[model samples]
Target chain A: MIKLNSNLMIHQYFCLMIRYLKKQNFWFVFTPYFWLVLFFFIPLALIFKISISVSEWGMPPYRDLFSLSEEGFKIDSTLSNYLFIFSDPFYIRSYLNSLSLAFTSTILCLVIGYPIAFYVAKSHANIRIILLVLLIIPFWTSFLLRVYAWKVLLQGSGIINSILIHLGFITEPISMLHNHYAVILGVVYTYLPFMILPLYGYLVKFDLNLIDAANDLGAKPVNTFLKVILPLSLPGIIAGSMLVFIPVVGEFVIPEMLGGSDKLYFGKIIWDEFFVNRDWPVASALAMSGIVILVFPIVIFQLMYAKYNFKNE
Target chain B: MQNTILRMNKLFFKIFTLTIGFSFLYFPILTLIAYSFNDNKRVMVWKGFSFRWYKELFQNEQILEAFYTSIKIASLSATFATIMGVMIGFSLTRISKIPARPFFIFLSSSPLVMPEIILGLSLLLFFISSNHIIGFPSSKGQLTVLISHITFSVAFVAVIIQSRLSSYDKNIEEAAQDLGTIPNMIFWKITAPVILPSIISGWLLAFTLSLDDLVVASFTTGPGANTLPIVVFSKVRLGLSPEVNALSAIIMLIVVLAAISVYFINRSHIKK
Candidate 1:
């Protein structure tokens, strides 16, 4: 009788707890909030702290920002890391190169991906889904593998050179493996789907009668594209460009594998600073500035846009 | 006659654009697949067609181990990320009184735009500091990599699940409640069944993101936990290797087949 009474009390307590939790909807918010706070926000705060610390040759490779000196609690910090990154031509030039690389690749992908997306979107509705599937299948395969494929094709004795030589276009195997052009080609090849998919998303929904109506109203093919299609697809173009541009700015793998030593890239420089030079402060400084220069502006823009829409409503 | 000529020109343009665009995408992949069967050790030379590289890949223990490790890590990371994502999505869509809602929104979305290299660096630094102060995660390896993958992957899954939940019909739940079904029972029976497909897709999306990660994995991985991309990257960076080509071809085939099967299943579902 005593054991049964205790069990009944425990069940009642558990039911009460469940009722309280449901009333507040606590589980849904608390679980993800706890994880994001620990892993995401705290890590970002830690990076900010380290970015200001002085570089030292200890095991962890940087002096503590807060320390207990003989006099009392003291803080040791330096701005030389940021200063060095800004004042040095090498670092500034690499940042420029990365920006330009991202710009060129974005344009290249837009020019090439636009037509494919338009045509695929305009294909027979019955086959449109199959075409879309085909497009996405290649994207799902190993990204490293697709880039590696280019390595094989661009090598001096690879298939491109073999075909060129067989056609008697050149007498010797031209060295084509490592260069800026090779890196650009590799980037364009890999990021093409990023461009195409968004364009397709917008284009597939478009009504074909608009094109016909434009033609009937005496708009020429070129004018129709300029006035109708391009303007309508502007959102997709911007979306696709942002997707490609932001990541490509910090691209490491393609540049490392395909680019020659003639030029340095922003990603490579930061990597070299941390691993090769073992300068933790410089690396952290570089990352901090990257967030400021590349990521912060876009975030601000998004917030402004959202506020504007909310106010309008 | 002029109208006929114009019509011919349109047809020609469409066909030409498709051929050129598609050829650019497929030419490199085809060449890579072709060379994987070569008999020669040197990648540049084409001696003959053979299965020598495939045999070599099976014998190599390092690549095989990395592949298995990647599968395990991806599965675990995806599962955890999916659970968290579902909870976040459910909260944001169904509940209106979440505390710190704006902060939660910012936390989930910011990682989408953050660069991979910077994300990788910050997480590694955080792990090191936490280890020094708390004396946990004594060394970075599989666990560290898993944690990093889940952090980034949760953003992607959450976005997908959020869209799915927001678009779903809420009247079904209301109707169930009107029929005198308890709120808890209605959620389990109706809400879960409706969102189950989205949950599955979120899991798969998370799986691929974790599997394909290289930069983040490199930062967090230690002595014993080399991933497939890391192994393949190290080999390919130095130059080409025949075994890697074989591995690429096999993976490509598997992916294409899987994608096709998924397409058919989805088509059948739509028809039904």
Candidate 2:
């Protein structure tokens, strides 16, 4: 009888705590919720609004969506901005350029980063921490400076050309500064750490004994990697790829710093459309299109993945 | 004999990969640091080593002021972001009855995947429209930049704090509650100490994000609020600047020292 009373007391306390927490949740939720709704969500909605508005020659540079003119409450909205983006091959080509750039850079980062992450994860315990710190140092440094480092190294009269000439690899100084290849190099170099860190996070926790288990079971080295290691590291690979791929799609600084007029990117196009052309409607349209193309699919994929995991669990 | 040869090959591969990786990572930085001491006006040309640019960097008012502005914005934004992020994280993980929870999650996490260019453009437009509508923030300046930084950084810190809070033990808080402790006291006494490391790291992460920003800062900034990156970028946009090289060396040195100290602190914590 005493034990039952104590159990009842504990249950009552638990209920009290839950009720208190549920009531206080509103206060905890209110500040950030209000801030995000005002700052982030509304801004995104504003972009959508401006995207549909008609471009006009004025201060705000676009006609209000709903005007109080003599046309009896007519909506001054058009899909023409989006149509303009789609109709021009220049805009379409820039989107393609960004996609291909992201794909290529992500692949290159993976190929390069995999070995580094693998080796670092496989290192002795004493060395792994130091290696991880070294990896993070570059990540924490100024990104512009890292890109600038490439600029300095690839100059016409720079060390790379000098070295190539001295080694008789080329007779004259080759132009390495402003090109697609230079942009790719810059992207891969800067994003390598992002790829390596996630891959390391997964690879470090991985069981090495599995390799030995496969080896003892007559599995060849390549087979062991393909069947065992690769399968297990898929989560890490996906995480790292997402980290590198998404940002590279909208990358502006690297390409601007390193690229030439030969290739224009989606980011650069959006920048020019807003800053250079002063086409607010068209810029908003491009950004909205980008969100539709890039963000929507990821959101759907994540939701479906969550549902799938829920079913399994 | 075969096993010995295989082990040797494995060791060789490990060494080869690490060397290539570290060199790829460090070569440019080391080169930049080495060049900072060059006496020539041109950065790359060989000359006797001197502290010429470092001396010049000290005298340059624009870069110095920009640096000060960047530091002020970064620290302030980091603090605010950390506080709001902790609230969001705590709400998400501890309190289960948040209304429109999915929308809340989307608002917090979407910024992580949003492109910096798009984010910058959207925030700039927001500031412009709001200013026009309210006639407040009569001009763009550091305040606009601070708001933008805090907006994006709250997402990052929320992720860090949420992960930490979820991974830690919940029994301590429950125990405190069962002992007749009040909710607020229980949080401060039990939960805060547990997640303190994550909060510190979150602040540091937000600080770096604000400091290193150029695209967003560019879109949001007006006259008199040029951050360090803005100054460095303008100086180097056409060509190289030796004084910027000195600045990079200083920044890199500070970063490396901070990283090493954090590592040591973590090690000591673990030992304890």
Candidate 3:
């Protein structure tokens, strides 16, 4: 009787375990899947819907895309917000300004960052760890404060001016607080780490033997670098560029804090459209345009990168 | 002679590059720290060294409250993001029959690269519509900000956890299963221990992101939800403040200390 009871108990346990696993599989996948779709994907889709909706003076600041009315099943959507954005020179100027800002900053960061990353990678192992930690400390610090530090330094009575005056480089303090130059300086200063980090990642993994081999084969230093090092680190260059470029294009705080009214960028335009102008549709349209402008090149780059890796291997 | 000249040139270039790079990186920060002790109200003018601003920072209730709120939200958001991130990471890597794997990948990864302003705007719109439709979250405050932070932070943590998961050998897990350990037991006893470091780091990353965020919090925040960055931004938006400098100095000290501790802990682990 005891043996029979134990066999029955084991059978029941197996059945319960199988059922639990089946439920676990479903719930495990569905939980996060549901949360992301509801929170992230839906919100993005909402941007498209709002971007196309007709603008009006109201609480929500736009007409409903689909509404129930006396007229059965009406859809009230228009692309006028996008049309308005494309039509205005103000909007066009903002987009161009942002693109140029992003491009200039990315190039500047690359120029300044590449050598630093390369040297850090080539440093002795002990020195490399300390250097990397030093690099990261600033990165982990509050970005706003770092930008504010620049603002303080550039003031009329700030240290930079005082030093310049004492050195007899200038007799009077110059205005340097708010301008396009300040904006670019702030962007490049903040985004330099974003460029350096990825470059260092790739460069640190690179073998030194290849360079020696190139030299043994009678290649000059510049030729070895251009042919072997540069091409091999192309992925890092692209990665670093993407990191700096995509965010710089939509930068709001640095511009708001440092930039003057003489220049306006896409981020500011989108912000003003929503908060200052209370034009929700127009703001959504601007954001949608930003997404398209940013994501398209990135998608193409990713595909090309994958193909390049496959061919190289 | 040629080799000596080339070696000298290389050494000079390296030194020059390092000097310029580090100075550019650290000078502004050093300036801020130095000025925090200035006696003058004007941040740029250095009257003398004093702790007046630091004293004022402590007594200031507005900043103190904002700091508290920031910490509360960051910890909560980081905790929730880590849990959900682990789920996503586990599901994606271990499970073979996930529904719509491509769409899932897109949802989890796109937030990593999306601009903060866009994410902020989208979430703000989402909350507005969701409230209108369902009459939930009746107000936008800490809750809204927490939700927004978690939604974005989940992707970061998921990436960390996923990379850690994929890199580790799976034979140990299979061996455990073959030895009569159930799936749940194997995960708890084996996988969890292996990925604990990633989980902790992921939590820290999410916490830092939440605390450092300004744009998203600005959009989603309502009355009584002012984060540290928002308060600091407002104080310094039109002008500078000495108290803010003091705050910056304090924050830098804390971050450096935390980083040192983390490095030491990692080194000790490596030694073991």
* Predicted model with the maximum TM-score: 2
DockQ of 2: 0.53
* DockQ of candidate 1 relative to the true structure: 0.45
Clashing pairs in 3: none
The candidate with the higher lDDT, 1 or 2, is 2
Q: Which sections of candidate 1 miss by over 4 Å?
A: A1-22, A300-313, B1-8, B97-102
Q: Write the per-residue lDDT of candidate 2 for residues B1-272, one digit (tens) a residue.
A: 99899999999999998999999999998899999999999889979899999999999999999999999999999999999999988877876654445666777777777888988899889999999999867889999999999999998899889878877777888888999999989888888988888999999999999999999999999989999999999989878999989999999999999999999988997788
Cα lDDT tens digits, model 2, A1-313, are 9999999989986787567656785666669868888878898999999999999999899998987867688788999999999999999999999989999999999999999999999888889999999999999999999999999999988889999999999999999988899999999999999899989988998999999999999999999999999988887787788888888989999999999999999999989999999999999999998887787545753454233222311
Candidate 2 segments whose C-alpha is farther than 4 A from its true place: A1-22, A300-313
Docking class of 1: acceptable
Interface RMSD of each: 4.4, 3.9, 4.8
Most DockQ-accurate candidate: 2
Ranking by TM-score: 2, 3, 1
Classified by CAPRI criteria, candidate 3 counts as acceptable
Query: What is the per-residue lDDT of model 1 for residues A101-168, given as tens digits with 9 covering 90 to 100?
Result: 99999999999999999999999976788878878877887888889999999888888888899999
Error of 2 at B263 (Å): 0.7
- lDDT (Cα atoms) of all candidates against the true structure: 0.85, 0.89, 0.89
Tally clashing residue pairs in candidate 3.
Answer: 0
On the 0 to 100 scale, the lDDT of residue B115 in model 2 is 86
